[model samples]
Target: MNFDRKYLVWALGYLVAGMCVGLYMAASKNHAQRVAHAHILLVGFAVSFIYGIIHRLWLDRPGKVLATTQFVLHQAAAIVMCVGLLLLYGGVLSEPVLAPVLGAASLGVLLAALLMIWLVRQSGRAEAAA
Candidate 1:
């Protein structure tokens, strides 16, 4: 699909997966996936949806390089963070790799967020100047 829709699809997928995880936890009475559930719902679903909204609202902005970078970073961060958190919560990742993966994912997410903020602020300034 289009640019914004891609992120929205990812968000929706995450929401569905999160719901399944929640249901499984409820049925099995095992709370170990609590962290994974939270991350998928919040970071994956909510944050990605927000990014999609931003993309939709600012569709006409120039500087495709920045926009593309932000989009890639956001998607990558969401995927990496979700997977890393899932591995950590499931006790699959070892001590050494766990921290690094999580840290890098967190940094990627932070950078993408900051980039989005910058883009929005820049657009606001441009509109004001116009």
Candidate 2:
């Protein structure tokens, strides 16, 4: 299987952004701002970069139903987590409801990523067999 350098770049960018956010949070005194920045860096940059890497590296069946389903689930979770973070930062969502919900969405994204990796590995094995 061919490797994509773009995924590496994307992952590095996310790590850098997350680190920057950490620095900013360290300097800030406000709790809310720190929380918001942390979520943005974690979910927006970190999760997104990971997703890009997964998409670039994984070479599963082109039109498989499971592949499509996983992709949709992954994207959907990412979107929801991002939006939820934004809402929380904007003070539109209370922590009691929003934080847990966003956390759950992020978990879904993680699960999807795992499933995609498994599918890609299976496909690679099948190709080797053939």
Candidate 3:
């Protein structure tokens, strides 16, 4: 429904996903997915949860187009990064081909961060004006 709830849900989902990865690593005794697991937990779960808190406590209009775009962009980029790392580490994909894809995904994450910066600035300006 609301943007804060959406972010919270996303965060929880990522937490489950990340924990699953961790569990698999423990079971298989193959820790090659460490990078992916870490990213999923930190970038996916922690960032999204913090975003929920920020939107709920600070943002007046968290459902704006830019905010929605930023949320989607960050999720997509994190998914891409996690999947790419999995494939790369599992030897399912070669580095030469996946490197550019991972680079683009990383760039998407940066863009999402930039979008969040803009959203925070806009929210601050709105709050000040009010």
Candidate 4:
């Protein structure tokens, strides 16, 4: 029910999907889905799990506005990036649209990453001062 648990669940879903993709790729001997498989496993599963762990460990403000911002931005960007990558890799989307979509998604991820860095730095300072 909590935000952290929600992320963990999402990560698990990604992990299952990624595993399925990997299995399919292996069985078919087709590596066209390599990009999607990697992103699904790394960004979707690994990053989300890491995000959940960070939330659980850093209990400064569970669902504060900044936390909410980071969560929403990161999730939105991840979805956008994953979808864009999938479409592009599968030739479902042309370069014109894919370029802008993936570019914006990358920027969004960068912003969210910066916010996380700031949070970690803040926590580090607090711990040091204590």
Highest TM-score scorer: 3
Cα RMSD (angstroms) for every candidate in the order listed: 1.7, 4.8, 1.1, 2.0
Sort order, lDDT high to low: 3, 1, 4, 2
lDDT of 4 by residue, 3-105 (tens): 6887899899889988998898899998888998899888888988998888778745543777778878988888888888888888898879899989999
What's the TM-score of every candidate structure?
0.89, 0.59, 0.95, 0.86
Kindly indicate the candidate among 1 and 3 with the higher TM-score: 3
TM-score of 3: 0.95
Q: Candidate 4 overall Cα lDDT vs. reference?
A: 0.83
For each candidate, what is the lDDT?
A: 0.85, 0.63, 0.89, 0.83
Instruction: Return the TM-score for candidate 2, rounded to 2 decimals.
Output: 0.59
Comparing 1 and 2 by TM-score, which wins?
Answer: 1
How would you order the candidates by TM-score, starting with the best?
A: 3, 1, 4, 2
Cα lDDT for residue 95, model 1? 52
Pairs with steric clashes in candidate 2: none
Please give the TM-score that candidate 1 achieves against the real structure. 0.89
lDDT of 2 by residue, 1-130 (tens): 2123433454465467556656765777445555545655665566556655655656634336666676567657766775676568658978788978888897988887787677777878877988
53, model 4: CA deviation in Å?
1.1
lDDT of 2 at 66: 69
